[model samples]
Target: MSGSLLDLVKALPTDPSWGPPTTTETMLNGVPYAAFSKGDKLGRMADWTTEGKDREGRGGRQQYNQRYRDQIYGAGPALQTVFNIEGQNEENTFSLVDNSRTTIRTRGFGRGGGTVFRGRGQRGGPTQRGGRGTFQRVGGRGGQQGYDNRGGRGGRGGRRFGWKDYDKPQRNREASVQPKDSWKVVEEIDFSRLTKLNLETGDGEDIDDYGFLYYYDRSFDKQPGAPTSVKKLNVLERAAYNITTSNDPVIQELAERDEATIFATDNILSMLMCAPRSVYSWDLVITRHNNKIYIDKREGSSLDMVTVNENAADAPLEISEGNKDSINSPAQLMMEATHINNVFPLQTVIESDTAKREMPHEHPFYNASEETDPPASKAYKYRRFDLSLEADPEPLHLIVRTELDAVVKNNISGEDQFLTIKALNEFDNRAQGSGGALDWRTKLASQRGAVVATEMKNNSCKLARWTVQSILAKADLMKLGFVSRANPKTSNDHIILGVLGYKPREFAVQMNLNLNNGWAIVRTFVDMVMKEPDGKYVLVKDPNKPTIRLYNVPKDTFEEDEGDGIGMSVVGEDGEE
Candidate 1:
């Protein structure tokens, strides 16, 4: 029953857990999906949103987007990369660390508080006879002339009353979520235009082989020393063609109240790239419209369009042939094929001090998707990057610069930033571009030299070591069994890995501090994640990346909580033991 690495990875979450209290109000076919304001007809709560349908479409494969309620919007957690450093170079001999630590001082009991009694002598000044103060002598009845006081009518007095002690009301700390400036809009928007008359396309969602969900705006590229913005989600739209009668309660209420907080989500899908394989110059614009992005990809040469119409069959012509879209993709298409290559397991060039490390056909880093930090190494170089268009200010470009520097400096912390792996493949570093658009590919080629230099400097660092210790206590062994193996795969780099490039953009959220419209960028691209004898994630070159632990969450995910004692690397030779 000993815990396995695969066991922990298998416990990760694939999708996010979302529900109410934190969920946003939404509507699909007039049905409510989440809590929404009742005052605004459109539920315009500053950052709130709703969706619409494309009632102006001709037929299947048209650019028509029918609004629907997929799911209520929960405040999705911000995306981040965790950085961690591991201790290595434990010496030629095995350096075993004792798991048991001695606590100098135990933590538990403490002196409790006592009542400040003042009764009689201890509290209240000796209680007055009867109640508090029942009597107060009135000098002489009414001070009329001496004669008027025949015999002071027994002086009368006002009655006394008591009040209860009060204290201030307390506040619930967990319920206090402030407004967020960032939002993410994931669109499987697919476009493929055949001609001015014919079109064919599909949703990127169902397409398995290739698809992209990048931010139109560079908003999360805040790098080291650059201004960074907080990132968050912005859309809650679904296919209205599939919605039920009552929309999400919150969205319906907001829209009914004439209140809305929608912005343009610039996502456009068309058959512009449809001509059997020909490229089509396409344009589309989408504003944040009630949590969902109100796309305006309507043009003369376009197919269908989503408009503000309650009817699904007939609506205003939002898309036309020549309508210019504010956020449209330029006419371009790369070589593409209809068939996808078969999926196969990746083979690693396992390293060994003496014995070859064998993986149980388990994915690299336990999960091919999860990015666990590599320990420091004598060398380290990341050739490619996955730049976000969401980094605001400083430009996605600036963010890329500063962040890369921070990574080298081992300073991956604070806002919109997390440690992520560009490539899990220990493959050679000579591979070319992989995903995204022209800008991304170009950035990859441009930053290759710079990324290498940065990696080289760190890899050559004299101060670096990694120490990994896995053990089972007496109780743990009785229940979970013993640590059966000591397997670690190190990277080798004598072979050619994939190529890399860098392109930075703005933060996913707008940064108030940044004056630039977009974030700076840096990109790294490759045909594959290389696995050589030299690049096996040795601890010598790993820098200040955060430790992202694998939790037992039943989904493939990363937990911010640092465990496994990773990312605690030492620099130079004579460092901590």
Candidate 2:
């Protein structure tokens, strides 16, 4: 038998195709032919269950093992058949659905270093089991425990309870004037776009100066917020006017003579220039008639009111938003601040007609017969800034009616320095929306810098607007009075804590305010209006978003209200209202 086996092996070697085939043909019919070494050990021809189990359990390594199995059996085509069978089989198509709850054991550092099971508990709520670091349930229904890493119902890793957190109520301020269906949206410019604009303008030329300024009281400049320095904010019955752009007599005369293409009051113009810094909503009425643009505000506009903590992260909340403190509410605080500003300037100056600085023109809005009280210490300077680009055929100018509050005698030059006085009021520092301000009554003496810095941060928009107005009017100094409420719970009375003075240009530098950017913003809006036809356009700042939209409307849009005498009466050049 051994001799016969030896003869058969010799015969297999003698035959040319008896040994391992060396043919280069890759496929025998439709099956892929895989070349394998003679030393390779062959496994089972087809083990579908094990292959499937390996693939589901071992992932990529199982796939590698399957490939190795395929090479051993030369069954790559058979594996494709098995895949096709599994895909087409109706039995395989139907999956067993487990109705009962499932517990998924995941690798986690649990209690006693065991695996954690995340599953539904007996109380019909999701629970994390077997871990000290397991999520604690909170605010679940029916005594059901729900997984919460932060031990709260909201979510994991939310803002902590603080002034700038979700605990603070949301402020949803209404627009100064809502848009009508008739109004057509012309352009929408974002605050981001306005910030990038820059255009250098020349120092405006003074067209005419109106009104007179009383000499500033030097005694109020003593140590602010001190017992000796604090004074009651008195209500002054002075004729102070905030006339709109189109209603101003001087601007009307300038428009007829074509002195400038654009006209705006310092109030309206400053708001537009400092729009990017503003957090609240405001609207400007832009009337284009006979190639002239007038920027005006609506009757009973919020722009007329001074805001409190407007730029704060957590600004004053409205009473509707669960704020029970009516005195500290946004509307009341605004009224308090506005009243203080109107009276603070008048109180800070000595109303002496003999020692006052009189303008070239008399007070434009003050009347001798119709008004009972004396005129406020105010100076209206109609200044014209050159907004002309090099490409323009004619010089484009903007005439802004800027105001000065008081006049101070310069100690060094002995010249009278013009001043623009604005007040920053403080409510309860412990109250909500205080913007982390210091106690001005105590800190204003030694930590005055810190108090002022806090005011600058919280009241950035208001301060920026005041600075812009001062710079536009060419005022030498900007006086900021620190006013606080007499009682935290009452808005009826206020006390002047202190008066801080700053040079307009220097303050602009510290605030990083770019007048060139403001001029560019003005020019951009001017160009937008210039391109459109003669009509009434409203530039509205979005109440919630940082955007300003320009809408075109009919000429008679706001005329009904104006006809009702809702706005300030038009004052003539002869000081007749």
lDDT of 1 by residue, 501-526 (tens): 12111111111111111101001100
Clashes of each: 201, 0
Compared with the true structure, what per-residue lDDT tens digits does model 2 show for residues 114-219?
3223445333344434544454433323333344564344322333365346565566778878899999999999999999999989998998999888999998
The local distance difference test score of each candidate is 0.19, 0.79
Per-model TM-score versus the true fold: 0.15, 0.71
Any idea how many clashes model 1 has? 201
Q: Pick by TM-score: which candidate is best?
A: 2
Clashing pairs in 2: none
Report the lDDT of model 2 for residue 274: 93
